[model samples]
Every structure is written in C-alpha cells, then in structure tokens.
Target: MMNPFELERYFARWEFTAPFLLSASDTEPLAMSELLRLASPEMSDAWANLSLGYTESTGHPLLRQAIADLYTQTASDEGGEPPHAISSDDVLVFSCAEEAIYVSMRALLKPGDHVVCLWPSYQSLYDVARSIGADVTLVELREEAGWAVSASEIEYAIQKNTRLVIINAPHNPTGSMPDHDTWRTIVKTVEGSGAILFTDEVYRLLEHGDAVPLNAAATSSPRAISLGSVSKAFGLAGVRIGWIATRDAAIFRSLETYKDYTTICASAPAEILAIIALTNWSSIVSGQEAIVTANLKLWEAFMSDHESLFRWVRPTGGSVGFPQWLGEGSVDEFAENAVQEAGVMVLPSSVFRHGNPRVAMTNNFRVGLGRKSFPTALDRLGSHVRARYG
Candidate 1:
C-alpha cells in the first residue's frame, strides 16, 4: 500500500509557541488564577468540597446554559426561543479548539471529498482536510480589500463534489469580518449545495469596532455548523472547553456519536471553571477588550509610519492583523534573514500555503498586538523591514 504518512508529516513541523512566534495567536490566554479568585467567594467552599471525576459527555448543564446565553436568539426574553432552545443535547465539549476541529473533520469528511477553505487561514483547516484525502481548494482573500472574500467568488468555486465550505471570521491572519449583506450572500450560496458551512467564530467576541454578535451558521441555516471556544475572547484556553452549536439535529446526533470515540467527556474542574467564567463573561470580555484596544493603537501608529515598506489593512475585529511586506527583495528571504539575524519571529505568509516570489504572494506577516512585548517587537520588525526594503 502506498503510505500517506509522508505527506502528513510536514504538518507537525510548525510550532505556534513562544520564541517561535512573533504573533502568538493564543498567547494572551486568560489567567485561570484570576478567574478562580473572582469566583472564590462564591465557590471557594464548594470547590474545596467537590470531587474530581468525569463530567457529562454533553457538558454540565450550567456550562451549557452559560454558553447558550451568548447566542442572540437563545436568550430567555426571546420567549420564541427558550434559554437552552438550541440543541444542547449533543453538545460535546473538547479539550481545546484544535481537538474539536480534528474530531469534527474526521466525523464529517471522507476521502476524495471536495472542500473550499479561505487561504492564509489557520493551517489545520487546510492540512487536516488534505490529510483525510479531501481535495482542498484555497480561495484567496483580496489584498486590496483588506483580505476580505466575496460571495460571488465563493459561488464560483463550488464544484459538483464540494462537500464543505469553511470560514474563520474575525479571521485569524487578516481579522476581516463580513458585513451582514455579505454573510447573507454567503449563506444563500451554500444553502442547497449539499455542502455544510463550518464557521469558526473563536474570536467573535473580540470585535475591534461595532461588529455584530457572533453568527452561528447553524442558527441561520440547516447546513451550518458553528464552532466557539472560551480560549480567544475569554482568555480561557486553559479550560480547554469548546463546543459546536447547531440546529441541525442530524449533525448534532452524528457528532454526539463521534464524541464517544474521542474524549468521551470534559473534565469536571474545567467545566466548573468555564461555567464560572461564562457567568461573568461581560466583565472578562471588557478587560480583554481594553488590552486589545490599547495595543491596537500602538500597532496602528507603527504601521502608519512605515507605509513605504509595509502595508496594513486595519483589522475590523480580532487580536491579529496580517500586513503585507512590499519589500524590494524576496518576502520569505526577508523573513528568514530577519528572524535569523534579528531574533524576532513573525510568520511568513507562505506557511499559510500562499506562494511567494522573491516577494511571497502570501508575503504578509501576522502582528499580535495583545502581547506585552508586542510594541517592542513591532519596533524590531519595523526596523528590519525598513533596513531591508526601504
């Protein structure tokens, strides 16, 4: 048998951790101790008296209810919809967002299926889909338009065998969020294609402007599966709790059955902590927003001064931004030389599978302004880009 392992091996080479990342996407993780301290007065006695054990496979009711509150139509006052109106029956909590992505892809896709994904995305979507024998197509984001995707382009890409369309909004690298009209067009495009739309809303709560609340494709259509996690906006990656919310009973049932084979259930302590965090979500989100806002101002100023060598499309929302390197020489060469010589780590766009010239077409680099060292790091990057290209 021809082994497929070699093709899959490269996916493991990249690491998104400290010292390797100039734009560490998950570095601004929520402090568990701070959350615990906030909840101490209410649960110190009870938490100390609780037992450690396997939690409900679907998730503890309190945590599920807390998560449900985030959805607009699921609020209690919207009597047309009950508090837990959406299907929580099959909500399977995973260790983290990555696990949920893995399980969901494995359960949903088969070999030779066709999947359409946005380019310069989180690598897992592209690599995982490819690893499973799916024909993956990369739809490029418009650099001129702030890395946004158009519905017409999506419609044009659909093939007879297209089985799934995946999107990350408050997008990772570009931080682009589609307007309501754009989303409506997207939903219409995928509605009857027999293809499911997997929308990753992990950074939904971190909107930089007057962005709308997170939209679960599941709520708007029967073919959408929405993924949310406590990691990004809530800064609680340590809790390792992420869930899929869908109104599609069939998907719910299928993923529930699929869950039994993977994690089986979430940890009790994590669930409890997640529930507590959700209960005070507003406060937690506000604090994070403050940090993002402060750092963004600093980033904006840096980008403004370096327009000749680097160009940026200010992110509408999310913690990161992708700025293109318009240098005179090779983008990858610039990045490699800069990192080796400068000891600064910024992801080259090529890793996102966008090709490079002496200038990488995916020649953009991500800037995560949330880190405390981000300002200094940006200064380092600016100096390097100017020295090489300016």
Candidate 2:
C-alpha cells in the first residue's frame, strides 16, 4: 500500500479551519491585482483573450523558453559556465512542483530498485520510491549542526544497486542550504555510485540576501534532473505552474510520457499567467523577498524573547524554520494544544518522521517565517507555552 503525505493529510483536516496557520511553506501568495501590476499591460490583454482549450502537454513554447532562460539565469547567478544553457525542449512543464516530483520519481523507479534520499525532506522524495516497492534508504541531515550533511553519511548510504538519490536543497522545514563544496561532494558521491540524482530546487531561489545558490543540479551530471516552480519564491501559487528541467533527452522524454497518466497539461489560463510571471520575475521575487525579510525579523524577536521556551539555529535561506521546544512535553502534543487552545498552528516535526534508526526523532517543529500573521501566531504560541509548560 502506498503511504500518503502526512503534511497534506494534516492540512486536509485543519488547513481551512485553523485560525492561526504558521505551517505553510509558501510566503504570502500574491493577489491577481498585484500580479497584474507586476506584469506588462499586454499580458492583461492576453488574459482577456485567453483560449480555453488543451495546450501542448510539453508546455507552451513561450512558457518553456522563459523557464529555460531562468535556468540559464540561475546558472549565471550561481557562478557556472559562461555558456550555461538548457533548451526549452529540455524542460517539461507540470501542474505544480509536487506533481513534478511525483512524475520524476514514478518515471525513474521500478520494482526492486534501490533509492537513497535526504532525510526530513518533502515526503514524496522517499515515500514515493517506497510506495513503488523500491528499497528506500534515508541519510539524515545533522540537525544540531545547522542541517549540515556530511559526504561520509551520504556515501555510507549508497549501495551497489542504488538507482536514485534525491535532495531537497535549501531544504524544507529547516531552511538550511549547502555550499558549493558540499554540492560537489554530493555530485561525486552519486556519480561514483552510479545513481541518478534528483535535485529539488523549488526552494532554491527563495534564498534571502547575497548568499548565492548552488547551480542547478541538472548541470552537474547528464543523469541529474532539477525541478522548479513559480509558487514559493515568486508567491504565485495560484498559477500552479511548475517544471522539470534537465540536460538529458532520455529523462525529459521519460517524464513527459509519464505525465500523460497525470494532469495532461496545465490550464490554459495558468500557462499565460506563468509566462507573465516569469517575464516579470525580478519584481515578483523582490516583492516576496521583502515580505520574507520583515517576517524573519519578527520571528527572530519572538524567539529571542521566549528564550526559555524556544531555541533555533536561524535559517540562512528560505522562509521555513525549525525551532526546539525548550520547556515542554511532547512537541506534537504542545502543537495541537497551541492550535486548539491558542488558535495557533505550527507544524510539529513528528509529521516528518522517517523511520531512520540512525537519527533520533526530533522534538522540533517547523516555524514558517512567511506569513504576515507569523507574529500573532508566535505570540499565541508563547503564551500557551508559558501557561502550560513554563
């Protein structure tokens, strides 16, 4: 039986009803009016005259070209080859990054295949492989070391039959990022083991400040594939447009074929919106970065004030944070109480637990520094902790 994503399972139950939601990975989503202001007037006119029919399953050519350009831009920003390039044909657009992940994993995995994944990641990385009856090995990130991953740990997990390895960099929950050196080591490890690397870079562009992101993983090896989306960094979740960008023609063809069983193509309207979003990318990213910066400041002050109750290695990139419950019972129980009693909802790390015997299940919870309501949610959380556990 296939295991469903626990986070989505939790959200399906409480997301709509929860009064204080602090667990979302996305920064505050942009409204259509704000999006229009960022885009050119011609884009609005295009929306007005949009056709309501099936577009190319590979994606609209213009949309694909814009995404290819972004990968080129990412390569340049991350200090890669001056001739950095990926063709629009190398990209396969999907409904969302989550679907991109599923499509990639499903296309690559087979019965009896062996897969290794970075632990405490977005569940689909490991669970999807497991659900396919593949042997899934998880290598844990060092939590106390600011989510640092050692090459030895990853190398140790690799086996002769290892078919795939996945990494969600600028990672989820913890928001920690790896340096260029780490990326090289990881690439070397996977290459040596002869396993394809699947890099999830959906959160890569959300990096705040001057910290440069690693080059797209697809560029590291012919077998490697990278995923990107318009949701997180650009705050355009409504568009629900995401893609798989790769240098390998075989991988691109495989996923594109598998995508037929899934959502055949993105909506016509969303494709137009995605094209407009990418066309106006700089302004969209900058606007969301400003929101992330302000929210981070508030999160910092709240954690500092409640030192006895919370402690964290502040994030270096992305908007999610994992904070320890300093004075508490089970953090899972505390989080539920906060939601029900204080109307504050923060994700307890329990939901992300992978059965890796090497890693101790943490008593930490994901604290999202993405929403404008973060301060009020923190306030309610602090008050509840003081009353219940202080």
Candidate 3:
C-alpha cells in the first residue's frame, strides 16, 4: 500500500492562490542577487565562471567540510573547543532536507520493523517510515510541560524489535526543543536500546535566546544520523542543498546507492551558492535572527491582545510554532473559511498531531515568525481571528 496522503498539503494547496501566507516554514528567502551581496570577492569570482556539469553524488568536498564545521561551532561557540566530532566523510548532501529524509528512510528500513517517533512531527518523519512497512509508535511532547519530550515515555514506546528512533528538536509546529540535559538523557536512552537514531535537525541553526542547541552530530553511538540544510536558517530554500551526517560508513554507502536512484546529485550551482552561504554563516544568520526577534515582539503583542481567542507555547528557536486557536466552529472549517474570507494561510494542527485523544492536539495552528512580511501577515491573521472566533 502507498503511504497516507500528507495532511499539511491540504492547507498548502491554497498557497499560490492565497494573498498572505503566515504558515511558511522557511524564513524570507534570499534572491541570487541578495546572496551575491554576501559573497566574498573570491566566491563572487567563482560564481562568475560556474560549471553546470554533474557533481559528485555524495557532495562536493569543500561543501561537505563546511557542514561539518557548523556542527563543530555548535558545541564550541559556548566555549573554546577543537575540531568537530563528525568528519566531512560523514556528510552526504541532498537536493533539500526533505530529500535527505526520503533517501535515508528508503535505504535503511525493512518490512515489519518498528519505529518510534515524536508526535506532531513533520508528517514525513513517521509517514514515510510507516510507508516502508514499519510499525510506528509516537512519543508525545507535553504542551503543559513546555513542549518537551519525556525520555521515560520514549523508553516506554519502543518495542523490543524497534529498529529506529527519530528525534526532531527545535521541533516544527510548537518549536519545542530539549535542553542539553534532556538531550543527553535521550541520547543515552536511544543508545542503550541500540536503535539507530534518525535526527531531523533541519531547524538546528535557528537557535535564539537561552536556546541550548544540541549536536546530534556529536552522537557517540555510531548509529545516529543527523539531517540538516540551509533552507530554514540561511533562507536559501530555492538553492535546495541539504545533507545527512552519519559516522556509520555502511549507512552512508547505502544512502549513496539510494540517492542515485532518486535525485542522484544536488544541482551544481546550488552547491556553489551553499558554500558561499556557509563561508558567511554567522553574518547571514545574525541578520535573519534579527528579523525573527523583531517579528517575535509583534507575535508577543498580538498573542497578548487575543489571549481569549488563541494561546501558544512560545518557541525557543526555529521559524514555526503550534498555537491553540480557540474558535467556536470546526477548526478545519475555520482554516478553510479563513483562507476564503481573510486571504491568510496557516496550517491547522490536525496536519501534525498524531496520538491518542488525551494527547492528540486539536484546535491549534502553525505560524512562522521569520517572514519579512510577518507584521502585515499578523494583522491579516488578527482580523480573521477576531471576526471569526470572537
């Protein structure tokens, strides 16, 4: 049987037709011209004579090293440190973070395998694994507990034959993240169980304010795989270069074969741009963070003004968060009608919520704080919420 149809696309279907999109997962994207503005003279010179030839299926050597370097900084930025734990050889670039998830699932899972994943995850996390014939279990995050996962619950969810464990932090929708202590607990749990961990870390670079970023790349167990890319943090979604880092030589080898059957290689020019983006990573991200920080104030004021109609657990990091929309009628209908009447697009929680009734979240919606137009978008969203719910 085929995998279940993705539910987020229900809201996304109107993306092009809608006037304002507040649910986008990426920050404001950079135009090639804007990207050129960040490039050094040497990088600019390289782009001038760019080649269109097919690149290595895994990734360019320089680009791979750049990704490895980011993880190195992730740990040491808090203090002085040495080389990154995961080497460039562990990196395998993909066309986008989405593609990396797909190829990893395809190459690794077998029929009848058991998988444990976080609830309210990007649908691909569980759906794709389920499609491969794995029996999936979801370990939910408690919204009352600041949207953090329970390591004990995770231990309870896995079956004896559980083959994989998935962790997504700076999580999508609610944007929950495990603090460093909690993360280490999870790592020990997964490692103890001897299950391969597939970490969706696409949002890793979006940390702000007291957000202690964890390094899945520094996983001591050779079984953990980290997924990351330039889309969210660097606002280069159009470039579509992402990668998976695994110290496991076998996993990397298998992914290479699976990738060849699919995208084979990222676009050559995207690789060139990715290198330039990384070369100036701190500058690019700091500017993006400033936009998010400012927009967050707008989010704070709007939420404070409309607490009767909506409420949310503020995200620690990343572009998106899940917020409860306490409207009177069916939330699905409200979402649809809002698009028709208000010209705003946001993803309802049903797209992400998966678990039992007690824990299954409803009446919530996902919104992005990273857009340049979020101030205007917030106004549109407020008008709709007031008219429809109040």
Candidate 4:
C-alpha cells in the first residue's frame, strides 16, 4: 500500500518554538499523582489491590459504565434517555482515541471506497482513509467564515460511492465549531446519503463560549460513529483511554474483530486510572478549563496589539486556534526565523496541508493556549513579527 507522508506529520518533525502558535498539542498533561490523590479515601487501599493482567477486550465494566453515563442526556435519576444510552456491547476502548480511529478506518473501509473529510483537520483522518485505498475528498472550511464548513459543500462532495464522512468539531487547527443549525444540516445530509459519519469529539468539552449541545452521532443514527477520549479535554493523555461509540452492530463487530489483530485490549493499569479520572471528571475538567480561560485572556490581549501583522478568528472551542501571519514572506521563513531568534515554536499553516506554497505564503498558523506562560510567548512572537515585517 503506497501512502504519502501526512503533511502535518512531516512539519511536526521540524520543531521550533514561539508564542501565538497553533499546533495539535496541549499544555503539560495532568500529573498522574494528582489524579491518584483524588481517588476516594476508601478506594486508596483498593488501588493497591488492582490486579495487573490483560483487561477485557471490550473494556473494564466500571470504565465502560462511567463512559456511558457521560452520554446519558438526563441526570441518572431523572431517567431521560441516559446521555446516549448505548449498551456496553456498543463500546470498544482502545490504547487511545487514535487507535480507535485507526481500527475503525481499517475495518469499515475497503479499497476504492470514497470518504469525505474536513480539510486542515487532524491528518490521521485523511491519511488513514487514503492508506486504506479510499478516495478521500477534503471539504475546505472558509477562514472568512470562522473556518466553518458549509453543509451544502458537504452534500455536493458526497457521491454514491462515498462511504464515510469524517468531521472534528471544535476542530484542531481552527477551533471552529458548527452551530446547531449547521450540525442539523450535516447530520441530515449524512442520513440522506447513507454514508457513515465519523465524528471526532475528543475536544468537544473545550468550547470557549456557549456551545450548542450535540449528542454523539452514534445516538442520532445507526450510521454515525463518535470518537472520544480523555486526552484533549480532560488533560489525561497518559491514561490513553479512547473509545468508539456506535449503534451499528456491524461496525461494532468488525472493529472488535480487527482489534484482535491490532491491540487485543487496552492496558489494565491504564483502564483503572481512566476510571478514577472519569469519576473525578468534574474537578479535573474544571481545573483545565480555568487554565484555558486564563490563557485565552492573555492571547486576546496579545492579538489586540499586533492586529496589523496577524489576523485571528478567535477560537470558539478547543485549546488550539489558527491565526494567519499576513506577512510578506513565507510562514516557514517566519517560523524558522522566530524559532532561531526567539526560542519558541509555532506550527506553520502549510504543515496542515493547506498546500506547500499556501503553507509558505499563507499567513495561517496554529497556536496552543495550554502552554505555560503562553502570554509571554505571544509577546515574544509579536516582537519578532514586528521586527521582521513591520
């Protein structure tokens, strides 16, 4: 199988640092000690008793049940279709969300299948689809429209042979999210076309403003699959817990079958740690939110001053946002110069496959708000841009 190196992966290999950067990265992950310390006092002893062995292929029952609870729409006691009400049978936990995505792509797609994916997205979605010999089409989001993709564009991109439509809400580089109306249009389009929708909701919880609540696609249609994890939103990438939720029994079965050849099951310790994290999810999430909120303030202040050299559509959700350089030279030249002169790293927009010259000439780049002292970094970056372009 001949597959090209994903654009983002290739750029990520060349590292540089600066403030006002956007990349599919996060602040330092939550310390495991901090999580373990949050364990119930009674459970502290139980932690010592954890047996190290191969976890159940599906997932630990407690972990699965906890995850299912997140989808329940109403409070458990109120009994309004528990967030999503998917049975444990419908869930398959993996080493990480990436693994869940990989297995799903491998299992559900065949050579020559067609896939529609959002552009400037997490590269894996398109790369893996292509690796499977699926003809992938990218639906480009408009920068002028807060990087939102139109439903009509998606409809036009769909063909009778298109088997899947992949999307990431609170998207990676742009942090743009569709409103309820747009989402309705997208879901309706997918339903009408009978294409399986793969929704990556790993960053769903990081919305910066009032976010429209959308259920996992798995809950809405038999053809939708939702990918989720504790990494981005919860700051627990180390736990490596991610899952595929779908009401489609065929997809569920196929994924399980393919997993036998890949990772048979997730690690036992990781599962236990994940359960603890979920149990204390409210606190953990709140802590991360506080960090994001503070960092955003700093970002806003920094951007306000450098309006001439930078153009940014403030992210509506997630930790990262893409802001254009709007400079006279290439993003690489600017990025390389910034790294050498400022000792900070920022991802060039070209890295995300906006195309090479687009990467170079285009001013767009990604920034992560989770970094320590991000404000300081942005300040340093602004100085560099002013020195060069101003």
lDDT of 2: 0.82
Residues 1-390, model 1: lDDT tens digits: 122332123223333322434666643666667887767565656566667887788888877777776675323222122222455553556767777787788888899999999977877766677778888888888778778878888888888899889988889888888876687679778877778898888887788765655455666677688888888888787788899877777777777778898888888888888878887888888787777788888877776787666788888888888888776665667667667766567666666653222423556877776656666666777776667666
**Which of the numbered candidates is closest to the native, going by highest TM-score?**
2
Task: Give the Å shift of residue 204 in candidate 1.
Answer: 0.4
Candidate 4 local lDDT, 1-390, one digit each (tens):
534545545445543323334343664477778888988874566577888888799998878877776666312312123234677667789899989988989999989999999988877788888878899999988788779868999999999999999989878878888876677679879989989999998876677755544667777667789898989888877788899888888888999999999889998888888888877877876677777788888877777777766778888888888888766776777777887787667777766673333342247878888655676777777777678777
- For 1-390, candidate 3 gives per-residue lDDT tens digits of 544445555654877888998888888888889888887887788789888899988898879999888777666433222324888998999999989888888899998999999987888888788879889998877678888878889989877888889999778877888876677678778878978888888888788785667766444457788899899989998899999998889889999999999998888899989999987888888888888889888988998998877788889888888888776765667778778899988777766645233445578888888889899988998888777677
Deviation (Å) of 216 in candidate 2: 0.8
Question: What are the per-residue Cα lDDT tens digits for candidate 2 across 1-390?
Answer: 666677778778777788888888887787887777766777788888888999999999989999988877767434444434788988899999989988888998898999988888888888888888899888887667889867778888888889888888888888888877787789878977889988888877778788877888886777788889988887778789999988888888899999999998988999988998898887777777787888888878877877887888878788788888876577788788888988877788877876333445678988777776776776777787778776
Q: How does model 4 fare in lDDT?
A: 0.77
Q: Candidate 3 at residue 188, lDDT? A: 75
lDDT of candidate model 3 versus the reference: 0.82
Q: Which stretches of candidate 1 lie over 4 Å from their true place?
A: 1-21, 40-46, 73-87, 354-360, 380-390
- Please report, in order, the local distance difference test score of every candidate based on alpha carbons: 0.73, 0.82, 0.82, 0.77
Ranking under lDDT, best-scoring first?
2, 3, 4, 1
TM-score of candidate 4 against the unseen true structure: 0.90
